[model samples]
Target: MNFLNLEIYLDYIKDNGYRCTPQRSSILSYFIGQKNRFVTAKSVTDHLQNKMGNVSSDTVYRNLHLFKDIGIIDLTFQDGESLFHLKNEINTHEYKFICTECGNTTDLNLCPMEKMDTALNDYLIYDHKFEVYGVCPSCL
Candidate 1:
């Protein structure tokens, strides 16, 4: 992802009546640095601890959820862990099949909503998560 995408997120928070704090900026920067990959809050906290010297897990998790709420990131569960990844602009509706052993993710180009019951389309839908978990080829 281009570094310019950082500005897009900054603009989003600003539009939502929120100021970009040092921690928030750092957290977003860390995610941007990761490009397109699933990462854990603990991984982020460890990175911040190595770079900034002091950061709490709670702070990391809070900012992660905040980013998710603002549509900047998406979450998935794989093998008992919640992994996060940046939502790509081109494939916002794509879901993934995650490897339980290796944490590898393969994008499914179609939207899972198409599989939903027709009668349930009357209400609003804020978000959804659909992932298939199993061993990857290498792990087999």
Candidate 2:
């Protein structure tokens, strides 16, 4: 995530009345500060404890939930393990391409919602859920 983008997100959170504790700021800073491939609470806690000294995993988890609630990040999971990543950049639509064998996920450029929107108008479905699972090329 870009520094400017993160500053804007934190501003949005502050405008809505979240306290923005130092731990929260540091947690957000960790996510925004790095360019990482999906991450877990333990990974973040370990790095932070090195910097802040003696932080708890519970604190990390709490901030993770806060970030999710305010839309700064998105949650993904595999094999009963949770991973967090800065939210994918916005676009006309979003797609996740998942590989079962190797347990990898890649973002796709196509926007299914365009066609789906047209069909939904006729069918009048009020909501949608989009999750597409398939083997990525490497796994194939």
Candidate 3:
């Protein structure tokens, strides 16, 4: 689901049993403005404080996790810090090669799980995340 619209996002939150608080709306708006780029939680908290006045980092972190849990955002770790971006599509599965040097990401067309079906025959997999980490050619 594309939540670029604040109203659509707020409605989603309400539909999912969450309150449409101003802080949550502002957070989603910030991510919407960022498009698909990943951003640090500190940056999100700073934006909230500057835009909404006296917002707490703890509150921001809590909501960020909540958003991720509900699949509104995607999360990754870069240099020991958590980074997040709004998920463009809810049901699409994507694998990516991530650059450790610049935090850049490139989508991979192949799904590794396709080759592991035999090994996973006894397992019931509901979901998975796949990422390859290395320096991009530009950084290399």
Candidate models: Cα lDDT each: 0.76, 0.67, 0.81
lDDT of 3 by residue, 42-105 (tens): 9999999999999999999999999888777778887788988776664356677777777666
Q: In model 2, where is the ten-residue run with the lowest total lDDT?
A: 86-95
Off by over 4 Å in 3: 1-3, 101-104, 135-140
lDDT of 1 by residue, 18-99 (tens): 8898888888788777756689888889988887888999988988888787777788766587888766652255477777
Error of 3 at 93 (Å): 3.4
The positional error of residue 73 in candidate 2, measured at the CA in angstroms, is 0.8
- Name the best candidate (by TM-score): 3
> 71 in model 3: Cα distance from truth in Å?
0.8
Clashes of 1: 0
| Per-residue lDDT of 21 in model 2 | 74
Please, what are the lDDT tens digits per residue for candidate 2 over residues 1-140? 23326566667678868977777777767776555345778888997898899899999998888777666666777668887766545211235665656545576667777788877686876534244666778866
lDDT (C-alpha) at residue 77 in model 1 = 68
Q: Using Cα atoms with residue i matched to residue i, what is each candidate's TM-score against the true structure?
A: 0.78, 0.67, 0.81
